[model samples]
Target: MKCVGLCPAFVVELWGVLEGLCCVRRLGFTKVELNTDSEAVGQLVKEGRVTSLLGNTLAKQRKLLEFDWIIDISHTYCEVNKCVDGLANFL
Candidate 1:
């Protein structure tokens, strides 16, 4: 994990997913299930939609998704994401 300084919450969330994906790839994992508490980011990824602020990053994410691996992106409740919150806080 690394500090990204300050940025919009959406960007931070997207960055987390990107980093998580990269980590999984580096770890030689061929299948992953990525969960996010941010509905906007999840929805955008699921629907393959892009925004001005996230177009490039989202495109990169899409490319990562195209790799020869299975990935599932899901939106979950924040309450169900406490473990991640705890880990983030620890960092």
Candidate 2:
């Protein structure tokens, strides 16, 4: 489920919950409960494409974590490397 939060820890927790739902579905379960806030659910409803609750939850989570840890780290590394290169040129 999508969780609206500025805190990284909360976002990670929400991600884990959504991933767990996928695992359950893969195991042949047809349903899952997404313990999330109203705002998140409202956003999914507004999209008008997510019919099932489970589908909506998974979609929201995927959207939130579109750039997961590896992507974030890679982007950060690239930025830092560019900065270091610029510093080296100046020196």
Candidate 3:
């Protein structure tokens, strides 16, 4: 389910990934490619490190991955990230 909402950047970004995970789980997909413009978030996922602020949510995302799905996530410059391009106009 694609979504957009009024919220801070961090909240929306985090929610996006978490929701994406939920969708993948529901669809019984074993692989996912996630992209984000935030390097900090990319690193967190790649290293399996959850921040205190998002610890619980991150844990849920982790638990959903026990299915051995290939999840590849990377960081790209916001200017080059097309998913967020239209959203930028609202800024």
TM-score of each: 0.86, 0.31, 0.73
User: Per-residue error at 88 for model 3, in Å?
Assistant: 6.7
Error of 2 at 24 (Å): 0.8
- Top lDDT hit: 1
Q: Is candidate 2 or candidate 3 better by TM-score?
A: 3
Give residue 77's error in model 3 in angstroms: 2.2
Which sections of candidate 2 miss by over 4 Å? 1-7, 36-91
**RMSD of every prediction:** 1.5, 15.4, 3.3
What tens digits encode model 3's per-residue C-alpha lDDT throughout 1-91? 3455566777567777788888887898887888888877777666767778779867877776566788888887878866576675565
**What is each predicted model's overall lDDT from 0 to 1?**
0.86, 0.44, 0.75
- The sequence of per-residue lDDT tens digits that candidate 2 reaches over residues 15-58 is 54556545655565543434333344334433424445256555
- By summed lDDT, the worst window of 10 consecutive residues in model 3 runs over 1-10
Candidate 1 per-residue C-alpha lDDT over 1-91 given as tens digits, one digit per residue, 9 for 90 to 100: 6687789988888888888888999999998999998988888777777788789878888888889999988888878789887887787
Residue 82 alpha-carbon offset, candidate 3, angstroms: 2.8
Provide the lDDT at 3 for model 3.
58
Error of 3 at 73 (Å): 0.9
